[model samples]
Target: MTSPYRVLRSDREDPTVLRRELRRRTFPNPGLAERVRAILQRVETKGDQALVELTAELDRIALTPSELCRTEAPEPPAAPVRKTLRWSLGNVRRFARASRPRDWRMRNREGAWVGERFLPLDRIGVYVPGGTAPLISTAIMTIPFAREAGVREIVAVSPPPIHPVLYYALRIAGATEVYAVGGAQAVAALAYGTESIRPVDKIFGPGNAYVVEAKRQLFGLVAIDLLPGPSEVAVVADEGARAEFVAADLLAQAEHGSSSRILLLTPSAKMLEMVLSRIEEEIETLPRRSMVESVLRDNALFVLTRSLEEALDLVGEFAPEHLSLAVRHPRSAAKRVRHCGAIYLGDYSAVAAGDFLAGPSHTLPTGGSARAFDGLRMDHFFHRTSLVEYTRSAIARVEPKIALFAEIEGLAAHGRSASVRVAGRGRHKENGPFLRGRPPSAKVR
Candidate 1:
């Protein structure tokens, strides 16, 4: 027997490993704030010249204005990928349309009319980071939401892609413009407009540690969608859970990046043994095996809990980016969760589906931000403003009480202002020429 193919269980816990994960979570990159702030100040002061110089220094993609400012993404795709172009574009359009609002209105107790109105930002910048591989979904996930928000102009910045899929995604998602700038410098250009690139009201999309830090620094000058940390997922599984499904779910999140944290909590030690075997067997056939291997060996964990109840408690504590209920009753298990950006019910719906076509926004709050925040939705795009109308009678009815309260607070002008309307226009100027403050009746009445 060549050693039970994947039952390698380690009851041995590493103190060093626990310390490393804890440190990564609480303390972000030191010196990032000062560095990004300095970069933003330089960009704001220098404008397009700064952008051009930064592109050369940071992105390694030197560009003149003509080369960098793309009115539209490049041409479509090759013959094979061309077939899928319309379908992909249509899917993006459909999601965009579905996420937009109808209208809203309401009447107040004063018979004064009031309602909420949603308006879109005039310009938006979308950052799509690519140092290693181009993320086509970066455009897909972000642009649709911006369009749905009714943003008239969408400028997308990426580290210049040689790949066709990224250009294709930008084209399909309907970004109005594209730029070749990359990293924190790109973020600065978007904040304080250059001669070529315009400042945007808000910025959306995700990136590496540097890009994220830039967004954090620029948040006050412009609205940022969310502070994205590393990608993470937690799978809560129980007895009779498919080992293949559990292993696959765990590996999928692990492949996101080396820093992504993936976890599998199960009540059964036997099931844990089964999943480890299944993961080894499946890894050989995977396209991204090396990345998955790093995740499996370093970033992922399989924990043995006292019971299913304890497993749920742990998942709640983690509040990961993506969560899966791989237990017997997935629906029931999902209900037990108090926090998570998105919840996958049962084994059939892998995290991939939610990432791509599912109606909900895939731009989730990560790194336990889910404890207080929520995933991206239409609400993230638009804010509400109240409308109010008060008639003469509405003012007259509340006048007496308003005047008395105003006088009580020593704001005599406030008391008379309310009383003037009801006290007759002639006496208004002289009504207060009585007692030091005038009796309460002379005020409100």
Candidate 2:
């Protein structure tokens, strides 16, 4: 029988081919972009009407403009769900609170006080994907941090047939408003605003390709958390790692979607064989077997490397969203990982821990974006404004130098403005506009 997953040997496969294979994971789709653009345009032009129409068409759930905004709060979740959500929220909040940066001021050598003032955004929009799954954990990961940052308005949007559990989770996580909307249309509404839903300052959370494309296109219009694509993971294991644990980690990431990428890099071929066998067996028992198989067919890989060093090099090149170090001295191995968005150390530390119970937000940068972007955090909700203060003495000390510098830059009025400030007067006839030019009478001479 054919192997369930492709096996690439570093000693045999060309490095260029390896890179090309990885690049396929992030290949651009014009069709997806065009579709997302249309949705965005429709929502931008038609407002709430477009949202209603698109939600019904795409999600197969009829909704009117009035129904866009959920009117009543959902009842509290059952004990088990509430308990888990509350626990997750507490962990996220505690971590966020501890990690949040503080506003600080320091006097410079010239006696000017300079500092950054961190202020919470007035409002933000959080997208919870209810299509394939409700993603209640997304609510816990996103909203609580906004709340901890003191965001005043937390607007939550998700597609129809939204699980009751999601509603309760949002409420528990401090969502001030909830709406029945999803996909690119929902992102557009949050970005541009509608008759009912006021535009938010920034939008957070993750979604499918359309949603990621929407965020990428609408980034400048409204502040965005990050352009996160499909979910992915890379596991760097060794002979010491358990095949079952490694197989489970790979399967966990694989079930995310067909577009998801899963990789296993190890020095031991035995470890690789064991993981592959375990995956084939365990995948048969999973509810999302088709999804796991779809990803495993093309996107997933089991790489055999000559050494651990080569495995780490492959990891840096991949720059996956979640990385698992299932080897002896996992912590030391983890230290070599410089690019992954999140690292799961040791066989005991499952990616699921970071996904659900871990304090850190599970919404991470994907599709090689982990090289530059960080996982969602509390600071994402706050805007930093720099504060500067200079006394008259401080201004006087630098005025002549400022004038000279402005003169050299050919801005006569810039020099004049500084000179006038030193003179303690407003703009006089001698000083023209901000640009360098002749005085009122000197022109035409």
Candidate 3:
């Protein structure tokens, strides 16, 4: 029987065929966008009342204002749970602390102390998905980085009937507030604010398409971690790579949702067939077999490449959120890949490790956005400002250049402003405006 997934040959088929197979599929839905926009406007206008109504209508859960805030925290997670979370937290925090940029100062050509100062945002909101899974790892991946960056406040939002494990993770990760809400409405509340939920400077984490769309619409209104549309993975394997390992990685990504995509590019036709067979056999054992099968049927692919270079080229074209190099020399093979959001080297380095226990946040760019965006990092929480300090001698040294620049730009008054500061004449004693308080006859050319 033919495999349920698409199998394309790069050597024998038209390049367009392979291109078509790799191109991301878009669901045309202006109605969904309009509806999300309306929901945002309603929450913005009606405040807490809109959140209460929308939670019942959309989430199928009822919540009052006080209940929405999750007034009291649950007891600390069980000993084992705490042990596991603390372990992961150490990895995430250590990596984040190492990656976080520091404020730096350097002297310029004019001897001015000019440099960049990094300051953490005042507040941030983290959205952890509740459907299908509680994603307790998301709390560890997102919140600790903000805390490590010294952010003033970190708020978390998830759909109601909060999972005990998720609550514990959020608390341990140092989330200042936890809200029981989800979907576009939750994003709207975080971006626009409501009576009970104060607005935040930025939002982080992943959700369904609606959540992604809401983040897209409210981008300028509030900062977002990245356009994490859906979970996706691309793997480049060689003949020596294990078929079961490749198939398991693909299936794990496919189970994320129907919209998720998985690509397997290799020159090994025999390995391709073996992985397909392994997938067919292994899928039946999974509880989410139907969901995995749907993704496999619609979005999964096993492409046959002419060479390793060809396979690596396709990896760059897809710009997958996660790229696994299952070849014999993963480190060397990874050098050719240019646009993956995260890279998992060797067969033993599973994407799940990066998603859960690895030192980096799994909140990464998706839907081909990895070409330009990066996985979420601690650097994302800070805003940078340039610091410029000039002494009187420094200002005097650059005054001619500054005046000439302003004059060339056709601003005579600007030129005078700079010259007057050094000229120290009349009312321009402290280098005030060059045009102000100048007598008609005393006007210098």
What local distance difference test score does each model get?
0.74, 0.86, 0.87
Q: What is the TM-score (0 to 1) of candidate 2?
A: 0.91
lDDT of 3 by residue, 20-83 (tens): 6575544536988999899889999998899999999987887888889985867786798889
Across 241-276, the per-residue lDDT of candidate 2 in tens digits comes to 999999999999988888888988999988988888
Question: How many residue pairs in model 1 have overlapping backbones?
Answer: 0
**Model 1: lDDT of residue 231:** 85
Give all candidate RMSDs, comma-separated: 8.1, 8.0, 6.9
lDDT of 2: 0.86
lDDT of 3: 0.87
Superior by TM-score: candidate 2 or candidate 3: 3
Error of 1 at 230 (Å): 1.4
- Rate residue 88 of model 2 by lDDT: 90
Any runs in candidate 3 off by more than 4 Å, and if so which? 20-28, 425-445
Q: Which whole-number lDDT from 0 to 100 does residue 180 have in model 2?
A: 90
